[model samples]
Target: MSVLVYTESEQNKFKKAAFEVASYAKAVASQLGTTVTAVVINAEDTSELGNYGVDKVLKVSNSALDNFSAKTYASVLTEAAQSENAQVVILSSSADSKYLAPLLAIGLNAGYASNVVAAPLSTSPFKVKRSAFTNKAFEVTEIQSETKIIGVSNNSF
Candidate 1:
């Protein structure tokens, strides 16, 4: 299964976390023996999403997502991931992602990691490291389900 990294933009420019998410996804994809695909909504240019080392870009032209709302944004991105057959979804563990992370996991029926760091530890069993104790320590957690959703720290990659 492939990776789907969610990136956000502001005024046509890629958000700083966008590149950060891509970086993490690239590593996860490599460890999983699959490629990473990036998804951006209301982005000015889909080509720019490719700069992050993902295999392809999925740009959703949505005006509603131009303004941030966790539910709305998650809905759009969740659809994109499904269309791409994403087995693993990655995002920065920001406020928005915290809300979107759980929602998307429910929508996709994917296992969730809400505050994550590092790459997937095992491919067949699917384990990822995440921050515990308010980002103080790291824990290697297993998704335990078919699909995995991870919310990573912005610069952890």
Candidate 2:
């Protein structure tokens, strides 16, 4: 019922991509008449997430998770998404997210798409626009899954 966005942080500060992903997720949630829930790990300032239209935030702070591990991060994100019963999961196409998205998708049994440029065209059938062929072309993808995952390329919005 909500859109879950994974907002990655570095050195206790969130990257610009985090806000972008939250903003994108918020748009999707608005279209679906739901809310945006952001998941952050080791982030010092989660207040800004609300500025990006995040309705809620789940913060996981653990010394054991100080280092970024694709497997661990994906596992945590998958759990958060499931707990929220998120209809959509949004991540920025950062280096870390690129490594984590597919694993999270597999764990959640959701359709995954990368380099997504915009929000869904329609929630039903879940259509989205993606940049294809190295941004030289575009395609509309229809994801026929109950849950959907999107990796938005940096600066795509």
Candidate 3:
């Protein structure tokens, strides 16, 4: 019942959008009565993730991870999520998430909400509310998978 948040930090602080993902994960974990953990590939101030209210952090450090590449990064995240047995995968709708989220979703066959803003009310049905077509509207969808991937809008809780 844990939620795994995928985030990256730049310039020794968390990226602007990653905070919202953390906030979202913190709240979702609170409501679900579970722990929230974050995965970082190459970040400057990874300890800042703790301030976001997550319980634990999984850092996948590698010199090769210095640059951004969707395919490679998503591959790392996929394994991390499986190792953690995360019920929900949380992401921010930044450029990175836009590129990597779907690959993670497709790789795991986990349901994805690319412009998500919230977590599910219950895990039994795995439903969530997400915006679509340029943040114009929202719809509650039932994710058809044992695992769920949520991509929250940038700078929005």
Candidate 3 per-residue C-alpha lDDT over 15-72 given as tens digits, one digit per residue, 9 for 90 to 100: 7777788889998888778999899776655777788877888877788778888999
TM-score ranking from best to worst?
Answer: 2, 1, 3
Show where candidate 2 strays beyond 4 Å: none
RMSD to truth, every model: 1.5, 0.8, 1.7
**Which 10 residues in a row give candidate 3 its minimum summed lDDT?**
115-124
Q: Output the number of the lDDT-best candidate.
A: 2
The candidates, ranked best first by lDDT, are 2, 1, 3
Better of 2 and 3 by TM-score: 2
Tens digits of lDDT, candidate 2, 1-157: 7999999898899999998999999899889999999999998879988899999999999987899999999899988998999979999999999999889989999999999998888888789999999899999999998989999978977
* lDDT for position 89 in model 2: 94
Worst 10 residues of 1 by lDDT: 43-52
Better of 1 and 2 by lDDT: 2
Best by TM-score: 2
Task: Count clashing residue pairs per candidate.
Answer: 0, 0, 0
